[model samples]
Target: MSPLVALVHATPAAIGPARTAFAEAFPEAELWHLLDDRLAADADAAGGLTPPLRKRMLTLIGHAVDNGADAVQLTCSMYGPVAALAGQLWDVPVHGSDETMLRELGWSRPARVGVIGSLDSAVADSARRVAEVVPGAEIVPITAAGAAEAASSGDAERLSAALENAARGHEVGVFVLAQYSLTPQWMRLEAALSTPVLSPPQLAAGELRRNLLEAP
Candidate 1:
């Protein structure tokens, strides 16, 4: 059987981009999506990841594992840390949304890294993780104003513009899109700003394939 990769999404906007990423990067893997639309809203309302929210995330992950997922990827940056805990509990591989992206950034050892996200919490969380992996680099957290709304409404132009405006003044060695929902806009943002842009989904998909599908 093809390796089944479960993608747990905190918001609906992430589903399409993730599917596209996996399709391109690891087409042979079977993809399963589990979305909890209210997850992002609750986390935002709580101002961060609360104990209950963490438990809820674990429960969702546990369900995915129980349902025959060979590997699981959390698509929400805010809930990323939960993936670590899930990994300890489950035998299969578990990955946070930005793990591979942050790891690669650390490898590059960029002087300054810009992290762009549609939501403040997601940006902050991603920035925190980036700092953990690349302690020496400066982390710039850029919250693209109105980007969440633009993404939810499927306004690609507005989303791209918001991200570009937020990124314009920042002089960073590399820019990372901190949210899976924002991945689709990375290419256009990179072109407009003339800077290297990194997003999580594609990188995560490739990593999963290398570890699970290609490994002997």
Candidate 2:
């Protein structure tokens, strides 16, 4: 039987790209998607993950485990803290999509890490994650104004242009696209800049496969 990997998403934009990454990286694994777009809104309204939101997140994670998921991937970057707690509670592997990518960047000990995100909260949250991984590392967070709305509205070109503009001038060792939803625009951003662009989906997929599927 194939391993079941449950993907938890807080925004619609995350679903397809995450599925695509899993398909490309671990075709043999069974994929399950769970989405609650409102979770993102609530988190934003409350200025962070409120207790109720965290409870719902755990409930969702438990539901996935009960449904026979061999592993769970939190594909939303904003849910990092909740995901970290869930990881602790689950015996199965639970992946915070952006965590590994940030950790990898942190190891480089870069003087400045540029972060671009569609939402202001996501940018701040991502910066926190980076600091957690690399103490004292400088993090520069950029809000890709209107980019999220463009992506959600299916304006890929506008989204691409906004992201490119946000990342155009940054003298950082690496530029990290803070959300998995922004993964598709990675190449466009990369081409227009000299800095390395690190997006979470592909890295998370590879890490999930290695940790959950390939582990003995």
Model 2 poorest ten-residue lDDT run: 102-111
Please give the CA lDDT of all the candidate structures. 0.91, 0.84
Q: Which candidate has the highest TM-score of all?
A: 1
Assess the local accuracy of residue 120 in candidate 2 as a C-alpha lDDT between 0 and 100. 89
Off by over 4 Å in 1: none
Model 1 lDDT per residue over 7-96, tens place: 999999999999999999999999999989999989988888999999999998999999899999999989888999887898988899
lDDT of 2 by residue, 1-216 (tens): 888999998889888778888887788889999988888778877877889988988898999998899989998788878878987887877877787797788678878888899888888888888877878778899999889888788677998899988878778888898888888878778888867899798888888888866789
Q: What TM-score would every model get versus the actual structure? A: 0.97, 0.95
Candidate 2 clash pair list: none
Flag regions of model 2 displaced more than 4 Å: none
